[model samples]
Target: MIIEVFRANGALLAAGDDLARPAGLTSARWQVLGVIDGEPRTVAEAARTMGLRRQSVQQTADSLVADGLAAYRDNPRHRRAKLLAATPAGLRALADVERRHAAWADALAARLSPADIAAATAALQHLATALDQEPSA
Candidate 1:
């Protein structure tokens, strides 16, 4: 199951990259944008949320800011960890990718039942939770 999940993750990332290409984004970049969809977070927070390393996320966040897709704001609680927020351009890019993704997903969903998808999602989440609790090597 774990191996299958890993394979699925790779496949999903590839598909996500394809879907995001038109918006001049990659799956990684899209994920960063999505992390701050509702509210902003520091690069560390976004990294934790996405199950990624802070340094990698910080590099991507910096690139996004340079591209005018995201911005950094002052953090009242943290002096050094500035909050990362999606700019209007970033939001627009996300929306564009989401619209494309929705259509693609709709087509795929037609081939699979909602119940099956829900079950798979639940199982994956369970695995993720368990993995999160495990000590790193």
Candidate 2:
């Protein structure tokens, strides 16, 4: 089940790459933008939300900022920490990717019965919640 989930997600990520390329963003960068879309967050916060290491998210955030897709905002509450937010370009890119993803999801869903899709989605959500409650290694 885990392998199947990975395979499906991997395929979706691969298809997303094509959509992201025109915006000069990669999947990792897009993920960061999506996370920061509604609110700004420190690199650590973003990493934790995405289940990634701080260093990895920091590297991706740095690249996104360099490309003008994201910007750093002063965090008055934490002098040493800066919050990340998506720039207008970043938001647009994220929207584009979301639309593409939705279309792909719709096409895939058409191949399965509604009941099967609902069951799969519920199972995946249950598994994700269970894993999230586990202690970190």
| Alpha-carbon TM-score of each model against the true structure | 0.91, 0.85
Q: Which stretches of candidate 1 lie over 4 Å from their true place?
A: none
- Candidate 1 global lDDT: 0.96
**CA lDDT of every candidate:** 0.96, 0.89
lDDT of 1 by residue, 57-81 (tens): 9999999999999999999999998
Where does candidate 1 have its weakest 10-residue lDDT segment?
Answer: 123-132
Local accuracy of candidate 2 as per-residue lDDT tens digits, 9-61: 89878877876777777888888998999999999999999989999999999
Off by over 4 Å in 2: 133-137
Residue 87 of model 1, lDDT score: 98
Q: Once model 2 is optimally superposed onto the true structure by TM-score, how far is the C-alpha of residue 101 displaced, in angstroms? A: 2.4
